[model samples]
Target: MEKILVVSSNKTASETLLDFLRGSFKCTPKIVESAYQAKVHLNSDVLTELVMINSPLMDESGVEFAEYVTENTTANCILLIKAETAEKISERAEKAGVIIVGKPFSKAILYQIVRTVDIAVSRSVELYLRNARLEEKINEIQTIDKAKFMLMEYKSMTESEAHAYIEQYAMNKRKKKSIAALAIIDKLSEQYL
Candidate 1:
């Protein structure tokens, strides 16, 4: 259900680009004859998730369109350019926070590139979340350790006995201590929900 955009004046180029991308991505492209028409699509297609602009468009330059897209859309914008312009296009895309897929395109290459980008984005987001959780876990460990130490120090209970009591309390209540610990952490943390 992912939406894609293709701005190409040449029917052959549009078809070829679609042929390569469709084989790999679950993509529905808004094809247009010129970059100007692409601008219209960009404004209206709120659901679009990606853009592929082929250079040499009838109405506008691919680089120019890519700039506009970066300014206007949250979608991942990529360029389709000839080998000679590959470096140039990529430099611009990089500055615009987009990526470029070089022309003489192949289905395999497109598939690999798209898959890699998806994985990288997902992994980065995951790591950010995991790191935030790790901070919470560290605080939880400090609290639980204090609790365990209190039983040994104040009640004069052996370390093993204190551990057993906590385990039994946790089991009898049908609740994991880790879950309780996380609840404590959540209460302390300023979460939105």
Candidate 2:
């Protein structure tokens, strides 16, 4: 489930937002009356995917908090502000990756904005995971290459022989090629160095 945080000071606005978000997204959002409270929640280890801020929060205008969220967390932020102020700050907020929504917006508009942000967040996470896997694969390949080189230099084996040795060892032990490479490296290093 996506964790959402709503920061608003007005009782009526927060209640309306809670209802709309709960009804539309089918998720419960944590509501905080001030940026300070929101920060406390955000600082925790739990990952929050979305942050919706109603402008004129009791502590501040909420733009700063929106920027803070964008800078500090992976969560997508939507800042609801007066139409006039939104126009003035939209560029700045957008540069920081915060989506600005003008006040007096219909439930449909809010839903659309949230949906768009959700799609963006999902894509971003997918890309991040993909990149991490690629990096891990690259590291494993490098480790295997290093082990192969050590075998060629210290064991007086040809490149093909080193490769075959590692492959045979991995198959025999039912372990990954990288794990076998690491074991070879440890044994050769201990024996030679």
Candidate 3:
């Protein structure tokens, strides 16, 4: 479970937000009353995955804190402000680039937000892992390609002859091209040893 820090001055408001998030977001929240505490929470090497702030605090407004957090911290930031007809809360959320959860948050909306964030995080992790695998595969292919070219250029072997030699002598015995490709990379890694 990710740790989501809630930095808010309004005790009742913070409790309300926490009640909504704890069950749905399944996040361990650290609530603070001022931006200074929020800063301290951020600066400390705690494993907070997200940081939230209330709309109004004596030290600073939520928007200011959100902006500061977005600019300074790696953790995702959000401003939780009561929904008003004036559009002030929305304007601040947009300008800060931090997410906003409507005031008097409903259970449905809370779950929806948590689920949306979950999907986004899942997709990001998937893409990162996929890219890593692709890089490894490319490196393996390059190593095999280099070996093939070396055989052709340095040993004056035909393409078919080189392929046949590797087929006969490779660790996988040419059962799979991927096996041979990876073997080439393994052989190259030995040189750095």
Candidate 4:
């Protein structure tokens, strides 16, 4: 389940939001009365999927905190402000990728917006994981290549010979090709370099 963090100074509003989120989404959201508390929670290792801020927090207007969450974390943020001020705030908040919703909104509207943000966060996480895996694979390939180059230079072997040697070593040792390459690199570095 996705984790949610709610930042609101008003006790009544926070309770309402908490109930609505729990009932509608079947998830419990962590609530904080100030932006400072929210920041402390955010700094923890736990990953929050969504951050909902009721504007005019006791410590600061929620806009700065909303912007902080969007800029510094992977979490999606939604800022709720009075209808009169939402338009002005949206102009700046939207640029930071913060979703702005005017106050006096119905549960139905909030539900729809939350659902949409949930979908977007899910997709973003999938893409990020995919990219991380690709990067790991690329790094492994580069490491193997470096090992092969070392073999060619220090052992006076051709590229094909280095490749064959690493493959044969992995087969004989019952190890992965990358592990064998690393071993070869370490051995050669110790002996020659």
Candidate whose TM-score is highest: 2
Structure candidate 4, residue pairs in collision:
none
Model 1 Cα lDDT, one tens digit per residue, 1-193: 3577888888998898787777666666678888888878878877666777888788766788888888788667777778778776676678887778777877778777777766765676689799999998887667666556666666677878766766776677677765543443354343322
Per-residue lDDT tens digits of candidate 3, residues 116-183? 76677667668989999999889766766766665666567898886765666564474455567456
Residues 1-193, model 2: lDDT tens digits: 3699999999899999999989988889999999999999999935999999999999999999999999998788999999999999988998999999998899999999998887887888899999999999999999999999999999999999999999999999999999999999999999999
Query: What are the per-residue Cα lDDT tens digits for candidate 4 across 1-193?
Result: 3599999999999999999999989998999999999999999935999999998999999989999999998788999999888988777987999998998899999999999998887888899999999998888788789989999999989999999999999999999888898999999989998
RMSD value for candidate 3: 4.8
In order of TM-score, best first, we have 2, 4, 3, 1
- What are the TM-scores, per candidate, against the unseen true structure? 0.58, 0.94, 0.67, 0.92
Which residue segments of model 3 deviate by more than 4 Å?
A: 36-48, 71-74, 84-86, 89-92, 160-193
Superior by TM-score: candidate 1 or candidate 4: 4
| Runs with alpha carbons beyond 4 Å of true place in candidate 1 | 119-193
- Cα error, residue 59 of model 3, in Å, equals 3.3
Candidate lDDT scores, in order, read 0.72, 0.93, 0.71, 0.91
Worst 10 residues of 2 by lDDT: 116-125
